[model samples]
Target: MSPTQASRPSTGRAARPLAALLLVAGAAHFARPRTFDAIVPRSLPGTPRAWTYASGVAELALGAAVAAPRTRRLGALAAAGFFVAVLPANVKMAADWRHRPTPYKEIAWARVPLQLPLVWWAMRAGRKV
Candidate 1:
């Protein structure tokens, strides 16, 4: 088989999941926005909800771009950058919810480190594929 054909399946391994995850996560930003609203750090500029919407739009766009084979290379890079960009929010979420109830608080704390795997995935998948 040619190089193009050989490379197809490997990239697919990462592209499909990245696309799907971004799509769902982006929609979730709007669907149950309050959950996202609660996590925004007050230290950041603008209203939490507004930031929520902005990020949602970003995610939606990235999701679509990453899903398309033509745009996957750039989309993967953006997705990785996006993951890094949101690290602060995840940290704030963990701190803000630290004292809350069990499941909710645990979830909040979990988000903090969760970025690692996500970042790793994005980087690994986002390459020349």
Candidate 2:
């Protein structure tokens, strides 16, 4: 194998968890659309519910694509984009949950910085496939 190829992960297992995460997260959108809508940031146009469903669809698509070896690369890139595209929602969640109960409040706020790690994970998955 070429040096570059040798240096890369030898197996596709690295991305499996990421794919599963995308799938579960995507499903949650449909499962409880209202929860997602609550954090849809008023600054954005269109109903928050619409945005929630749209993002959910995107997540499902990305999850399916990334799970297949043939489409992994493109899916990974899309995953990264999706993660970034939803950052505003996370921000809104953090802000709205500020006055919520203890653990709930902290949990919501934690999702804000959590995006950075998620982005890095996406990048890694992208590079692997």
Candidate 3:
């Protein structure tokens, strides 16, 4: 096989974990929307529910795109951007939970940094494509 082809990840392999993560997270938004709604940054326009559902839809679509080998490159790239875009919501959650119990606050705070690895994974997946 050509060097480029050989270097590429096995078809859909690199993208599968990311795709599954998005799919599950997307489903959670709809399944337990109030949880997601609570984290929507108050600064964003429109109702929290609206933003929650929109993000859920975007996640589902991105997951599907990433699952397909033909679309994995663009999908993974977009997923990286999506990870960055949601930082505000995570920050909002952290700030809002600051007064809560230590465990809750720590969990919320942990999510903020978790985005970095997710972004890195998405970028790596895109490159492997």
Candidate 4:
């Protein structure tokens, strides 16, 4: 194999973890929807639950697309945008949880910065094709 090919992960391998993460997080939006709803920025139109469910659906669809070799590139690209789009919610979470106990506050704050890596991972996964 060429040096570039050897350095990059196989498409399936590179996409699986990201697919799994999206799938699980999508499922969580249904299983414990209120948690997700709580983070939805209040400034958005409609109810928080609506945004939560919509994002969950988007995650599931993106996960499915990413899991398939044929669609991985598009899915991963979309996932990168998705991560960026969700930053507001993470910021809202951090702001809302500022008064909570230390651990909870820390987690909320950490989520804000964590999106950067997620965005990078998705972009890298897209390029693996």
What do the candidate models score in CA lDDT, each in turn?
A: 0.85, 0.84, 0.92, 0.92
**Candidate 4's TM-score:** 0.95
Per-residue lDDT tens digits of candidate 4, residues 1-129? 999888777767768999999999999899999999999998999999999999999999999988888899999999999999999999999999999999999999999999999998888777753
TM-scores of all predicted structures? 0.87, 0.89, 0.90, 0.95
Give the top-scoring candidate (TM-score). Answer: 4
Mind giving the per-residue lDDT tens digits that candidate 3 earns over 2-118? Answer: 998887676466679999999999999999999999999888999999999999999999999888888898999999999999999999999999999999999999999999999
lDDT at 122, model 2: 75
RMSD over all Cα atoms, model 1: 2.3
The digit string of per-residue lDDT tens for model 2 on 9-106 reads: 84366568888999999999999999999988898889989988998999899989878888888898889888888888888888888898999988
Cα RMSD to native, each candidate? 2.3, 1.9, 1.9, 1.1
Which segments of model 2 are wrong by more than 4 Å? 1-11
> Over all chains combined, what TM-score does candidate 3 have?
0.90
Candidate 1 vs 2: which has more TM-score: 2
Residue by residue across 1-129, what tens digits does model 1's lDDT show? 789868665766888898899999999999989989987878889999999998999999998988888988888889888998999998888888778889988887888788888877777676763
Kindly report which residue stretches of model 3 are placed more than 4 angstroms away from their true locations once superposed. 2-11
Total colliding residue pairs, candidate 2: 0
| Candidate 2 accuracy as lDDT | 0.84
